[model samples]
Every structure is written in C-alpha cells, then in structure tokens.
Target: MESAIKWTSNETVLGFGKDAIAFLDTKLFSKKSPCDKKMYEILIIEPFYGGSHKVLIDMLYKALEDEYSDSKICMVTMTAKKWHWRARTSALYLSQVIPKQHAFRVMFSSSVLNLGDLIALRNDLADVKKIVYFHENQLVYPVREKKDRDFQYGYNEIVTSMVADTVVFNSEFNRETFLKSIKAFFKVQPDFRPKGLEGEIRQKTRVLYFPVMYDVGSHSKDYESTLHIVWPHRWEHDKAPEDFMKVLRKLSEAHCDFTVSMVGEQFTDVSKAFKEAETSLFPHIRHWGFLPSRREYLDLLSRAHVAVSTAKHEFFGVAMMEAAFNKCLPLCPKRLVYPEIYPNECLYNDSEDLFTRLAAFSRNVSAIKEVVADVKLDFSKYSAVNLLPHYVSLFK
Candidate 1:
C-alpha cells in the first residue's frame, strides 16, 4: 500500500490519496474560525521532561494558562535519559504527532530539540516564531571523564540557537558561558568556519531566571532546636554528593548535635559515594532518598535550619532557591550560580571552609537562625507572577 502521508511546501497532508481522503477529511488542515483564531496557542517542546526541567516547564505552563485567558498551551515531552538521542529525534516525533489543525502562533522549545533540523524539515512550521529556552547548554556542561565527552550535543545546541527567533537562558552565567564556549568551538573547527553566528545568536539572547512557585508555608517559624541540615539535590556525580558526605563526616568527627536529610531523586547508575555515606552516616540521617510527596518535602525543608550544596556544576540553583524560600539558611560553595543568588556570608571558599561553617552552624544554631531571620532576601524576582509579563512580551 502506498503511504498516504505527503509533505507539501505549506502543510503536511496525512491520508492524501482519494481513497484515504474519504477516511481522513480536510478538517486536519482546515483553518479555524475568526473567534477561535483570536486565541493565541503556544506549543512547548521539552524533550527531557524530568527533574528541574519538568518542574520549570510545568510551572510556566500553569502560570500562562491561569494568567492569560486568551492563551492556549500544548506540550510534547520525553523522558530525561539518553539526552543526546532525545535531542536528535524528538522533533521528528513531535512533527508527526502534533495535529495540523492546531495553529500555533509560537513554538517554544528547550535546547534538547535540534531546532535547525526541525525547522528545516517542517516547512509548515516556517511561519511560526520559534523561541528556545536553555535550561542547560551542552557547550559548558561537565563530563565525568574526558573520553565520555561528545561535541555533537553542543553542536546541536549551537544549531538550535541559530534557528531560534529568540533564545532565553536561566541565568546570566549560563548565557555568558554558552556564548564564550561557542567562540572557542569556532576556533577549534577545521575549516570553512561560520563567522559571527555566536554574535548573531547572542544578539537575540536574553537572560531570564527560572520562575519558582513559593509554596513554603508559615511552618518555617518553628525551627527545631537541634541543627537539621538538608541536601536537596539529585544524587548524581555533577551534584558532588561525596563532598556533602565529607561534610557530614567532619560534623560526626566533631560530635556535633545535628541531623541530616539526604533527599533527592536517585537514578539507575547510583553513585558509590551515596552507598558509603549510607553505611557511615546512617546514625545522623533523619530522612533519605526522594520524599514521598510535596507536602512531606516542604515539611522537611521547613523543619530544617540549614540547606547545603556541594555541586560541581550548576546552571541555575532551583533546589537552593526552594530551600531558601522555605527559610533554610543556605550554605553553598562560592562557585557557579551560587555567588549570583546568595550573599557572601552564605558562600564558602573551599572544602575546609565549608566544613568549618557546617561545624559552626551545628555548634551555634542560634547564630545561623539570627542570620536567617535578619537577612531580608527578596525572592520576588524568581516568582512566576513577576516573570509572566517578560514571557508574554516575547510573543510580541
């Protein structure tokens, strides 16, 4: 049987033959009425939809849907594993699945989609404005080993940026690093190099912080007398769970009166450090692994007095922001996105510095509480309500 699917310059026609047309009517490609056309529909493509990435897009969707009565949103997402494969193939799947009748004014996608490839193939989507949001770019992403490094993912991001009408990054650091890395990538290219593509992409780029929904209740007022520390980050190599375990070990050696909640999602390839910590620091652990529910997670966060981070790479610190919103005193490394989000007092220079601060916090809980109480940190900027206008303006 001949395939009924046929690609045209303006539209993709499914079941195109005369016999197939009787089964599949023109309703597939027909335009909407004037009243229906008044509505602005957006198609969001997030290939890696898990963890922080999922949380971010979900929040954005909710904000837009609730706030703008005239706007409509549709999502096409994939699981967050084998990211390279996802980036390579998601667009092909999306093009086939998304209905032709749905007239999307804008197509919002993450860096996970090879936008250049997608846009080039889907002539029907040519008229639709494309906006690419970078939660994390492969250009500056860290690899555990040199041999595991593949430049194709980074190249895909570069192509994605070039094809996008506008590009948004979650942090200034992320934007700057991506821009700089692309320049270096160009320098290393063998021949027939493209000039000014980075600059062109940069000109269209904008920095917008991830919108955090403030759900932390007033329960934070009741801080436990005992020092309760929380490490709410994924148990992965990039998060550097070993450093966190080392801090716990130092606290244990000092015989500090503290309890730790080692909470975060665990993947198949478990970090050996976590196993070591499980055995060694079992006594101090109050809660371990991913919390059962959001309520339970927030309750744990509220009860805790300090939130710590020992990440080796972070484009944006959403976990840290959530902890801070819950009134947990942040004690993070001075590198990555921490310096931009946290005050100098909250940052530690080295592992020894982190150990000293953790020990001090445990010994003098009152001091840290005072710091948390006195610090008038404004998290309003990260609020979805505040960021919605900026997002809406992008469609203009």
Candidate 2:
C-alpha cells in the first residue's frame, strides 16, 4: 500500500485508508521500530507483554514506528526468577528490554509494586509521552479483595499508573475495577478531597483493544491432534483450574473420551488448586506442566481441539485469543472480558452453563470441531496495522 504525504501552506497532510491487510505475527513482533530517527520517544510500561498482549503492543509499536519516524518507542518490563511462566514468556515478546537505571529510580522503598515492570518500563520510557498499559491492578485484583500484603503493593500500582501521561486498558471492565479501588482507597483520607482524581484519570483512559494475531489468510487449515485440549495460561490463581477439572470429571463420567495438554508454567509453591485437580486429571492427561518453549507450546495449541478458561479474573483473555487463532474451540466462563472476547458466540451463564455446553460438545463432536474453523476476531481492529497511526498521533 502506497502512503501519501501532501504538503500545504500551513500543514502537511498524511493519507488515511490503505490496503486492507492483516499483518504477519513476525512483522508485528519484530523488535525494531519502522523508523530509525529519535527526536522524541513513546514509552510503554507494563509488567509483561510476551503473551498475547506483547504481540499486540509489538504490532502497535511497529505501526507507530512506521507513521512517526522522528519518535523513538520503548517498552519497559521487569523480570525476576520469582515471576510466573506467563510473565517470563510475555517479556520475550518485547523487541527490546528496559534499561536497569529506570527501575532502580522509580521505587521509593515505600511500597511493593505488584507485577510492575519497573526495569523495563524505566528503560523503554522516554521523557516525551509516558503511557502505562495496565493489564491488572494489584491494588484491586481479586487477591487484593481477600488480603493485604506485608507492604501494600496496591498503593504502588496506584502511584505508578498515576504518573503516566496516558493510561490504556485492554478492556472497560479493567478500567472500572481500578477506578473503584481508587475511589474506595481515597475515602480513608478525610482531609483529602480527591476532587479532580476521577476526571484526571478519565481523560487519560481510553479502551484500546489488545491487538491479536488472527491470520485467517494462511492459517493452518489443517490440524492433526488425536486427543488435544489446550491450557496455555499461567498455572496460578485467577484462572480456576478446579472449574475446568470439574467439567472434565463430568466428561469422564459420561465416557466422553478426550485428552488434555496443560501447557502453562507453574509458579512458586504448587497452587493447591492445581495440586488437587491433578488427581482427577491424571487419567486423561497427555501433556502436563509448563511447556519447554513458546514455539513448542504454540505448536500444541495448533493441534488442540478445544481451549477453555474458568478464570474469575481476566482483563482480556489473551490466551483464549491464541487458542482461537490456532483454531481451538474456546469454552470459557461467560463473564468479564470473556463476553467481549467472543460477543459473536452466545455467552454462557455460569459453570453449569459451561458444563452443559461441553456436554453437548462431547456428544456431538462435529459441533465442537466446527468452532476451530469458524473462529473469528473482527471486532478488535487495533492490530499493528490499524494502531500504528494512533501511536504516531499520540507522539505527534
């Protein structure tokens, strides 16, 4: 597609529409920006991006590079041995790593920042336009609702996100959750009015759907897995493995033959949920524990028959998108971003609803098989190609 740059007396005009083309994942994930110039910079700070969100940001950065050559784009991330597998994998998606100087300066030793990629964020960040793309707010996450840590990380999240010139959320649900937490926290300060906080945050926040790779063009039209089910998420809380196990148990009882590949990383101490579910799941297991490599894991996704998530907390279901892109029937608890993930498919009511869906799916194999072919993501238009201009405009 040819891009036109027309000059006028007062300003120069940039062309709008181009050839309608969906880009390759490699192009989006390529580390360098389109332009080599560095007059200004667009910096994004996030805990992890290597998962589906990393792909989205890579594509967005690539697009920004193409449109705004004068601007330098950076992404910051922080990784430790303690971080989960999903976080580790997401960091790999970044073309570049955040510098060390930035991370050390940001922490005041006052609060523990939950999942804040302080190092990467400090490095990728420029003095120009600082954007914080928050996936989950530790301050108000489900775990936060239950207990407070020794050092409150929630305060750290609030302050970090507050520092950003612009705040971007993957979904409306996440933005609302964060705001509610901020509002609740503010009430404790009787003298503090916090009058402009809501308005200030609102102006910065705009829902930018995560760019995903759904290559319908040369997508592998062929799949060959004898017994395949995929779980390409982190082996931790939020994503309820128990709900999935229960459904699988019913399938086993019904003599609905199947095998599963639990393809995610297990973090820290063995989660009780994963531990407890292991006994029931041992019978039908084909692949267990975290995968060896990202490609190998994605390869498994390609062959899987179905992908399901019983998570109570998902800002945006990136793993599900990977499954859908790889041609898997996504069976999820119809809540949070799940509804937005697949508005086309009728959202199931609850766990029982998912069980009913799976029951019918097992009985009529063809019905489940068809989802692999028909899976589509036309709603999320912010893929690298579409979002490039926006990134450029933000810097401009």
Candidate 3:
C-alpha cells in the first residue's frame, strides 16, 4: 500500500473558502482505495505550515509512517501568514471538511490552533483523542519595547491545553515559562479567574525535544585561511539581525579577514538591518537571502566553518543543530535555548562577548576548529531513529 498522500501544488494553499471546502470534501471523503490497509488513522493540524514548524511536522509525519506502517496520516494546514486570522478561523474550516464518518483514532495539533475553539464547533473531533504540541507559546514570546503583547493568543493556548488530552512542549524552558506566565496572566485578570488551571495543564505537559533531520558528517575541509561565518535563522526582529550586523560592523572596523553567509528564509517584511548590511558589509558577504533548494542550503552549511545565533527569542534551536550536524561550530548567546543545547565553551555571555569571540576567531580560525574538534554533540536524543518509538507510544 502507498504510504503517503500526494498533494497537488495548488492544494496546499487552500484556505477557509468555498473552493477549499469543496476540494477537501472530494479529496478526503470521495477516495476509496485498495491501498487502505492501515490499522488506524491520525489527523494532524498545523495552521502555520512553513519554516521550522513545517520542517518539524514533515519529520514527525515521516517518523509516524516509519513507526506505524499500518496507519494513515491526514493533514489540514495553511500558509504561515496572517497568523491571528489563521488561529481564529482554521478550526472552523477543519471542522467542516473532516468527515464525521472517518474514525480518526487520534488528532495531533500544533500550538497555532486553538483546540478549544474547534471543540466549541461540536465537530467530528468530539470523540477523537487530541494531543497539542507546543512549538512555541505566546505567553513567553518577546515583543518590541513599544508594542503590547497579544493576550488573546496566550489565552487561546491555555484554553487549548485545557481541551487537549495531552500537551507536549518542545523544550522544558518553553513549558516552564508558559506555565509561569499563565499564573502571572491570571493575577492581572479583573474577575472570575480559573483556579488551579495552571496546575492541571502542568500535570499533563511533557517536554519532547524537536527532532533534527540531518546526517552528521565529518568536518568540512578547512577553507585555507578564510573564516566563513553563517547565520541560519529567519530574517526577523526576534532573531536580532541588528545585533548580528553590529558584530559584523565591529569586525569590519578592526579589518578582520573573514566572510559571512546570511542564509535563512526571508519573509515579505524583512528586517531593515539586513538591507543596511547589504551595503555596509557587502564586501564580506558570500551568500545572502534564502536558498530555495534544500541541497543548496545543506551545501552552504557544509562549506561554512561557524554558525552563529543572536536570537532574542528561541524555544528550540533547530537551525543551529542542522548547521552543527553539517560540521559548523556554534557560537550563540548564553541565554534562551542556547545554553541548554550548547556547552559553555560554545556560548558567550553577551553581545560584546560574542563580538570579542568572533574577532579572536577571525584572527585565528585554527583555534576555533581545535576547540570544536574536541567536543562531540550528542544528537542521538533528537534523531528520528531514537525518538520515533516515543511518538508511537504516545499516538497509540
């Protein structure tokens, strides 16, 4: 029997519309096949299906197929844009499309959707055992100094936790901070605060690290005398591209002999800092913007010597791990998810420390290589081969 659902190019962009409903109804309900040999079916809901979330979902899907060969996986997703609209609306579309007759044994959802909102619709999901996976939560999400936090999004996560049979966070930091923030949020509520909700949610929450889907290889050949630094993170504010550029500026002032590759997904609204870097740091840049092909991205990682992250917010560092697997030594901030993933030698105390480390690295690339050569990152815990069994047990 065929193992996966082959989706057309256009089918992925189908949103909450008449055309989407019609297409989903036909694709899901009208199909009758001799290949229907699965023992059970699982439905996956990922409203923001792009970047890291998309990568994680794809890995999970592949793992599920490998672990449970006789199971079917159905997905309902949307592009990663207009997130507020996606969160409030995607559930309604899913409720309308997933047939009542289809006995889905389990429904796995990402934090992007509010499962409580879906349950309120009183759809086919009523009897289905639901699991909510938190890629990141809005409660602990950092915002710009002048901007106000969206309480609605955080509240939705809390409600979804209440609705789900089990809640899983990608990191212990994410789980603890979110649970702590819930208490803080309730304290400020005017009236009718739900008591012991945090405790209830905490009891069911488990920390499962995100899987890294890449093969570890021998370190890349030394690029003679060049120091190739790569920033493999989204071009956004939370990633703190401005800070990365500042480091480059300092390097340029000191006349450091090195090259940089600013490689990651660039959304419609890219940081102005990157635009400025294009002119000021153009001489030092090797590759810029997103590489459409995964082969090309991996190739870039293979050639790079160091991977750096100056993120203000990171629940889990997926890109960093990917680069490390490709033999790039990581130099990241000592806070957020970095400290947990990397050893003390791989981290810097602050941005100034990071700049100092980079400057020293530029002068002597061999020293950096020597340090990295001695350390071995235990990536097995996040590998699909090791983590798939746990997922299978959870799904069962």
lDDT by candidate, in order shown: 0.74, 0.55, 0.75
Measured against the true structure, the TM-scores of the candidates, in listed sequence, are 0.84, 0.69, 0.87
Who is ahead in TM-score, 1 or 2? 1
Best by lDDT: 3
TM-score of 3: 0.87
Q: Please report how far candidate 3 places residue 358 from its true position, in Å.
A: 0.3
Residues 66-149, candidate 2: write the lDDT tens digits. Answer: 564313444443332343333333333332333322321111111123224443443443343455666665545455444343
| Model 2 backbone overlap count | 11
1-396 per-residue lDDT for model 3 (tens digits): 112232212223232222322322232221333222332377777787777777666556655665554237665567777667777777776666554556678988898888988888855677888999998888877776414777788889999999999999988888888888887777657789888888999989898888656543334648466889999988877789889988889999999888999988865576566788888999999998888666567778888889999988888888898888777889889898777778887888888898888888888888876878776688887765566567667788
Compute the lDDT of residue 163 as modeled in candidate 3: 91
Better of 1 and 2 by lDDT: 1
The per-prediction tally of clashing pairs is 0, 11, 0
If both were scored by lDDT, which would come out higher, candidate 1 or candidate 3?
3
Q: What's the lDDT for residue 293 in model 3?
A: 60
Candidate 3, residue 365: CA error in Å? Answer: 0.8
**Clashing residue pairs found in predicted model 3:** none
The pairs that clash in candidate 1 are none
